[model samples]
Target: MKFTCEKSILQEGISTAQKAVTGKSTMPILNGILIKAKNNEITLIGSDIDLSIETKIKAEIIEEGNIVIDARLFGEIIRKLPNDVVSINTIENNSIEILCQKSRFTLIHMNGEDFPLLPSINENMIFSVPQRILRNMIKSTIFATAQDETRPILTGVLFEINNNNLNLVALDGYRLAVRSENLSTDNVISAVIPGKTLSEVSKILEEDDENVNITFTPNHILFNLGYTKIISRLLEGEFIRYNSIIPEEYNLKVIAKRGDLLHCIERASLMAKDGNTNLIKLSMEEENMIITSNSQLGMVREELNIILQGQSLQIAFNSKYLIDVLKIMEEEEIVMEFSSSVSPCVIRNKEINNCTYLVLPVRLLNS
Candidate 1:
């Protein structure tokens, strides 16, 4: 393939597609990116069996052809190219030459026929959501997804669409994060999308108000974002019944400033970080909440003014878990509900019910 394109445009296309390139795959073709040039447009594709990314950029095509080149090498060369325009040409012996200003390099190309075909979704179950909103939904819940592969279902976020409401749920057994948004659809759909894939999608999404078209099938999901498309396999297993696990009732409610609580927990976690458990104790009294942590390194205690109601309680939790949810919240104040020191603590926005985070309290020996 021969094409000449602006360095910035080429770099972005290659960078986005490189996300799906398999790093240590047994198939050599999977490590390379497929480049296809035709009709003034060049497409870059990368796949790792489960996930694939393809992006197109406008180019000056001299010779319309297709070739597969090492993704890492191609990306590096494009990023370091010292000119505004870059020219790529395929030569004899399965090699491609890259030229920009005074710099030139040749890279051996792989057979494009060996690359696996990306699954195409032609189903009628397609929906669209604002890219910014979808990106926010993924970021808010993806951190709660389980990293362990033992229960593969929990490694993905549950996408539940009922009528116009869309709920995204992610839980790693210890914490559950749920984010809800309203869509303009009436279709009912449910799918378990891998969290890793969602994370990558979030990275490439633009911050503007553009809408992303999502197509879903029985075993795969496709996202079309203007010039880029991503396809990923859906996890096949029943996700845990998350709604039933969320506590319906709590006797104690504490409303506190999010920034104050976040800062206190961050300071408390510093001491706890030295230990294996990273435990921090929260004691809610009449009008104040005290956070304390003790470890082999040292101890930290912080007090924040809070509006407490219902009943007083003391609970211990992994400091990291609390910080994770609190850091993402945009509200000025947050509500924490607790049935008891042993029950799961629910944290949410004080004004809106758009998001909810449930964290299981760590058991104390004395309790």
Candidate 2:
């Protein structure tokens, strides 16, 4: 394959596709990025069996051919080269040569046929959502996904569509995050997307307000946006029935500034760090909340006054868990509902809309 292209264009595509490249692989071809040039367009593809990302860039093709080159090396080289045009050609013995300005480098090529075919979804459920909205949904829920490999299904986000609503949920036993958005789709479909894959997808998506078409099949998913299309394999198994676990009633409700609560919990977490899992104590009184954490070294405490209604109660939770909820919360104020110290603490937006964060509390002296 031979192609002369703008260095900036080639570099951008390589950087995006390199995210899917398998860093450690037994098969050498899996570590390389497939470059195919034809009909004046160049396509770069990288995959590691489960997740594949492909992007295309306009190029002036002198010869129509294909070659596989190491993704990491190609990205690194192109990124450091001058912003001039780049020339690439495959010569005898399957060595790909790169020429930019006065610098010359050669990359070893692998057989393209050995690379595994990416999963394709055809005639599957399709929906479109604003790129920024989808990115926000994943940010709010993906962090709650379980990392334990024992239950592989829980290690990903559960995406459910029903009656014009799209919901994404993640739980790791200790905490759960649920977010929903209204869409025009009436078709029903549910799939588990691995947390790692979704994280990469969110990162690759540009910050523009463009819309992305998401399609799901029984065994695969495809996200089409801009000049790149990403395909990821779906995890097999039944996702846990998550709705049953959420509490429907709580006697106490407290609303406070998002920033104030976040800082209080963060400070408490520092003291709680010496303990197991950084446990913090939350005492909800008539119209105020006291946040405290104690360890052998010292104890930290703070209070945040808020508007409240109903019975007073106290609860204890992992400080890190509360901080995680605050990290993704975009509202100015948040509401916390408490049933009891032992039951889950439900945190939601004060406006009674958008997402819910259910966090299991840790045992405290209140016991």
Candidate 3:
């Protein structure tokens, strides 16, 4: 293929597609990027069996053809090009020549025919969501997905669409995160999207008002955003019944400033990190909440003013778990509900119930 394009545009397309290239793949062609040039457009594709990414950019096509080039080498060359405009031409003997400014280089190319075909998704089961909103939803719950592969379904986030409401749920046994939003659809659908795939999609998505089109079948899910598309395999298994686990009532509730609680937990976590359990204790007494952590190395204690309701109680939890949810929250104040020290502690947004986080408290030996 022969094409001339602006360096920045070409670099972006290459970088986006290269996310799917696997460095340790047994097949040599999977490590390369397929480039197809036709009708003033260049399409770049990269795949690692389970995940694939494709992006297109406007280019000046001199000779319409297709070829596969080493993704790592081609991306580096385009990124380091000295000139704004770059020209790429296919040479004899399965090779490509790249030219920009006064620099030129020739690299071996693979036959594009050997590349696997990307799955064709029909427009039958499709939904549209704002890119910014979808990104936020993924960010809010993707962290709670389990890293262990023993229960493969937990490694993915559960996406459930019922009528106009869309809910995203994720849990790693210790904590569960749920984010819900309203959509303009009445269709019902559910799928388990791997966390790794969602993480990559989040990075590529822009914070804009543009809508992203999503389509899914029984085994795969497709995301289309402008000239970019991502296809990922769906995890096969039944997700845990998350609704049955959420408690309906609470015996204690504490309302505190998110910033103040975050700071206190962070300070207490310093000493807790040295211990094997990494536990931080929370005690609600009268109008103040005491946060403390005791470790073999040291101890930390802090008090914060809070509005307490119901009964007073004490609970212990993993400091990292609380920090994970607090760091991503945007609200000024948050509500924490507890049924008992042994039961799960629920944190929620005060303005709306769009986001909810459930963290299981650790059992204190003395209590």
**Model 2 misses residue 137 by how many Å?**
0.8
The best candidate by TM-score is 3
Model 3 has how many clashing residue pairs? 0
TM-score of each predicted structure versus truth: 0.97, 0.97, 0.98
- Give the lowest summed-lDDT range of ten residues in model 3: 270-279
Which residue pairs show collisions in model 3?
none
Q: How accurate is candidate 1 locally (lDDT)?
A: 0.92
- Candidate 2 has a TM-score of 0.97
Stretches of candidate 3 off by over 4 Å are none
lDDT of 2 by residue, 315-338 (tens): 888888889999789999998888
Q: Which ten residues in a row have the lowest lDDT in candidate 2?
A: 117-126
Give Cα distance to truth, residue 201, candidate 3, Å. 0.2
lDDT score at residue 342, model 3, on the 0-100 scale? 98
Per-residue accuracy of model 1 over 104-154 as CA lDDT, tens digit each: 898899877777888877946668889999999999999999999999999
- What are the lDDT figures for the candidates, one per model? 0.92, 0.89, 0.92
